[model samples]
Target: MTLNVANCQRCGKVYLKNMYGMCGNCIKEIDLQYDKCLKYLREFRSCSITELSEATGVSHQLITKFIREGRISIKGNPNMTYDCEVCGTAIRENTMCEPCRSKLAKETNQMHEDENRKKLREAQENHNTFKIQDRLKDRF
Candidate 1:
């Protein structure tokens, strides 16, 4: 009897079992959309997140995240200009993996809280100043 082996469509690698119709390596490769990126890369040679997004029909933020993870190959020189894959936040350089995603969420929440606190502080100060002005006006 002949053993049946599944092959990945993207990479043509043989796999014992199909994982969503693709082998593990091919899945990883396809996840980056490298082929789609290559077409744009060939046309532009170099592109920022926005430019690639418009050219490839992929979101700018997503492209940026892929670049940051080193998923998208550079034709000439390498540069860090990716976004947070999970949240679409622009990051200088880093993978938008689980840990980084968690950290970003925490920081974003903290920023919102800080902004709220600042608004409260400003309102309180304004109230106090108005009360003092009223008292001074009554005395004068």
Candidate 2:
């Protein structure tokens, strides 16, 4: 394991970087909030993210992070839904919905293909230029 020195993202305090980007104090506080959220969800299993945030005094952003990390799941609940990061489609888990994921995958593959084609074209042009220069030198 490598130890890295970095400033805590949450509190801006200098500390050793761990798996979590936050400092120890912030991590502890987040853990406490997680516990509270878990306890609340146990009682009200179908609450939306906003409702949970309001009830537990935790921020919606934090709750969304917890959900994305698989620490919390609100599956099969019609009232609870999160927007996909790419297309704003409602999703039950992860950052993107299935359609968006597929679309993004296709787009990424196309981008790679385009970049490869561009490099190939440039290489061919450079080779042609070199060949022309060699022919001119022979004539001289």
Q: What is the overall TM-score of model 2 with all chains considered together?
A: 0.73
- Tens digits of per-residue lDDT, candidate 1, 68-118, equal 557675436244255555775545555575677788899999999999999
Residues 92-139, candidate 2: write the lDDT tens digits: 877899998888999999999999999999998887445667888999
Flag regions of model 2 displaced more than 4 Å: 1-5, 76-78, 119-140
TM-score of each: 0.35, 0.73
Question: Which pairs of residues clash in candidate 1, taking residues 3 or more apart in a chain or in different chains?
Answer: 64-82, 64-83, 65-83
Clashes in model 2: which pairs?
Answer: none
